[model samples]
Target: MSGIATYRHTQKAPLGLLVYAVAIGMFLGAWFTDLQSVSLILALVGALILILGSAFQQLTVEDEDDQIAIRFGPLPLFRKSVRYDDITDVEVGRTTFIEGWGIHMSPRGGLVWNLWGRDCVVLKLRNSVLRVGTDDAENLASFVNKRLQTEERE
Candidate 1:
């Protein structure tokens, strides 16, 4: 793989952060009381909230011998791959908050940039799916399109 790049969406919403902060305060307050059990429960809940709020996502790009491979995650260990050749079209666009952010499996419209508010170019592939990634969507689309067109001509 070559020309690798990775990006993630925003960390989490402010409401989530506030909830965790309140839980921490409550847990500490309970610690000064006779009920150690309350503190333990709060601590566990706080931990879970923090983990859920840290909903970070990742995107990866690698140059295959004759194509490019792109992947996104719900989990880093589990990823989907897309080849440049299989890509039928590419376009730069937008992804709104209405559909939420990150690499969502059930996106309302299409694939999204996730972290970056502006939607990057999407690859409409032959396999009946779309992919979104790249720091510079326009340039990446041009680069890939030119490469593919040149290959077709050859």
Candidate 2:
């Protein structure tokens, strides 16, 4: 999360198909096969596929005055926040191909909160780091740097 006076952005990801794909696949598998033992479990879990889809359908980033907040939405079941004071540095960067999407622990150390693309704003914290994927990486990085400069002056 990047602290700000006012900033908000949402990045969309086309992951909503889980609602139909998962449920339909499970239903079809159960109907076409005799994997009865696990079919019931699959069917039950499949019923909740909408939640899965919504969870990763989009990502929203905003300023919460003292911290930056990022969330995976239309269901925002997962999120991360970073304080302006905690950020030691910020820069616009890109993730490697292996980094992939969604939230994960970075192989390079720290946490990665990504939705889709590789464009991101990397922030170095006091004891950790965060790579927040965004389509507006340049603007985000610039805004964060301004905030950091302001914080230093204060």
lDDT of 1 by residue, 15-122 (tens): 545655766776676577577787677777766655544433445554555666555433344345565677788777555556455566535544543543455667
**lDDT (0 to 1) per candidate:** 0.55, 0.83
Residue by residue across 52-140, what tens digits does model 2's lDDT show? 67788888888877788889988769988888999999999898788888788898988888988899999999999899999999888
The model with the greatest TM-score is: 2
Instruction: Flag regions of model 1 displaced more than 4 Å.
Output: 1-58, 71-78, 105-110, 131-134, 150-154
Error of 1 at 82 (Å): 0.1
- TM-scores for all candidates: the values are 0.55, 0.83
Cα lDDT over the full model 2: 0.83
